[model samples]
Target: MLKVCHMTSVHKRYDGRILKKECVSLVNAGYDVTLIVTDNKEDEIYRGVKITSIDFHPKNRLDRILNSKKRMLKKALNIDADVYHFHDPELIPVGIILHNKGKKVIYDSHEDFVQDIKEKVWIPNCIRIVLSFLFKYYEKISAKNFDMIITVTPHIVDKFLNYHRNVHMITNYPVVNFEDRKNNKRSDCNQICFTGLISPLWEHENIIKALNIMKKDDISYTLAGPSDEDYIKKLKDLDVNKRIKYMGVVDAIGVDIIQTHSVAGMAILKYSQTVGGKIGTLGNTKIFEYMYSQIPVICSDFVLWKEIIDKWKCGICVNPNDIDSISKAITFLKNNKLEAKTMGENGRRAVIQEYNWETQEKKLLALYAQIAGERVL
Candidate 1:
């Protein structure tokens, strides 16, 4: 078996795409897979992927960026794997180092960095433009040295095509077990849920505010994910806290547990989408997750999302920016439980047929096969 090592300086050891999905998938496909991450200091194995944990507790964001890359490079040099796949943008320089050592280096572009930089709320508005420009050019120059570039979306692949020679678009889809399709059959729960990142950039605040306007006092909510301490505190202050149950940080199983008892999902992802024309096209991971879990989604009515929702008849596409529209969508799902249950079943069917990780898994296996000079599956 060909040895493959995936390194991530920015993300967690169990990042869904990089580690859990990519590394775990590779392991099942008969590769000698290993993962290196910055979070955990103690090394261990879970789900067949061997993890090489590094101790790097940084004081601040800058320390993690600058220090993690340096530490990552030092540890990466000794791995000596046939292929080194890295996910962090900050690890671009390290990729070049591995390439020079006659190792196949793959850069996984997780996001459109240009747009991400523009949407970075922490970065000062004045310098964001300049930083975005410089980062784009820098990535372009660094990516040229890598063997292949694996991007999360087609839109992101376009951004790298001119810069990198070998690039592939691999959409991140939720891993749904079609065997347990019966479990996904929806029933009325009088509850709604939101899973994953709860941030202002993702318009999480809109969903919270909309709940206030909702007429249904009996409805409770479950928020299952990590959040900034300050922002979490702000949420605690909201009067809706009595109805909204915050599950702090939940694992995949925990999310499933929440979804099992939930009726609807709120997916208001609008980061880098505030512009009038730039509506999301590729779709968010949470949307697919909600679909697979057989939860009717109440999400932003972007053009692309509307196209998919209309075709699938899976869920309601609402104006996320307006609290009234969000509340109305919630009420519609609540008052009409049978309709909501049917919509949830439609969503699960959509996932089984077209939107599950199985399709993307084939693409990933084919890519790795090509890299290893093996016959494409």
Candidate 2:
């Protein structure tokens, strides 16, 4: 087995994409995999992958970005794995150093960092633009040194094609098991669930407002994920009827239970120039997760998402910013139970046939095989 090490100065040790998807997949493919993350917890083996933490928990975002990369680099060098796959852009320098030392390097681009930087609310607008521009050039230059570039979406891949020839698109699709395929009993037919980042970007206030517009007392909303106190307060204020159930930071099983029990899953996001709008691609993991969980999705009417829902006959796509439009979609799904069930079935079929993680896993394994100069079976 070829030894591989994946490092991240940022992101949790068990981040869904990094550990649950990438590292775990590699381990299952017979690779000796080790994941390095910045945490205060002791290192251990889980799901057959070695997880080593650097013990430098960040006091703030800046500490992680500015200081953790150096510590990650030192630790990565000591491991001396054949391939070093890094997830964070802050660790780009670390990837370059490993490449210079004759080890294969892979840079996994989870998002359009250039576009993402523009939406950093903490950063001043003027500085954000300059940093985006500089980072664009920096990323372009650094990408050429890597053995492979793994990206999440098509638009992100287009951004890297100019700088590297070995770029590949491997999405973060949900890994559905045999049990997930069987229909689980819904805990509440009128319950709507939203999992993932619970921020303004997801348009949660509007979602709650839409629920109010429906005027259905039984139609409750469940939100699970991390959020700030201020944001939680803002949401609570809007949820005057106390219909919203907030589950702060749930595990994978918790997310599964919420989705399986809900009548519909929500991914209605707000778009803006700073956030570069929707990438109009299959990058949103929530939509796929909702589908795989056998629940219909109520999401933004972006062209790509609209097309998928239309073709799969899976869910309703609505204008996320319009309260009435969102309310109408929710109402239709709630009032029509049989149709909603069929839509959920269609969505899961689409995922099983085309959009599941198995397809992406093949691409990932092939990329690793190319790096190792071995043929993939």
In candidate 2, what are the lDDT values of residues 76-165, reduced to their tens digit? 998989999999899999999999998899999888889888888899999999999999999999888898899887778877898799
Model 1, span 1-377: residue lDDT tens: 88998998878887888877888889999999989999756898979998987678778889888788877888787777888999888888889988998888899877777767877778998789899889878887888788789886556676688877789978778887767845554455878898888876556677778777665575777888878888877766673646678889987789888887887888876636322234564535877888888879887777767777999998998776887888788888888888988888888899899987888889999989988993222
Return the clash pairs for model 1, or none.
Answer: none
Give stretches of model 1 more than 4 Å off: 184-188, 216-218, 236-242, 251-253, 271-277, 281-283, 374-377
- CA displacement after TM-score superposition, residue 86 of candidate 1 (Å): 0.6
Location of the lowest summed lDDT over 10 successive residues in candidate 1: 271-280
Task: Give the count of colliding residue pairs in each prediction.
Answer: 0, 0
lDDT values of the candidates? Answer: 0.80, 0.86
Alpha carbon RMSD to native, model 2: 2.3
lDDT of 2: 0.86
C-alpha displacement of 215 in model 2, angstroms? 2.1
Superposed on all Cα atoms, the candidates' RMSDs to the truth, in angstroms, are 2.8, 2.3
Q: Which residue pairs clash in candidate 2?
A: none
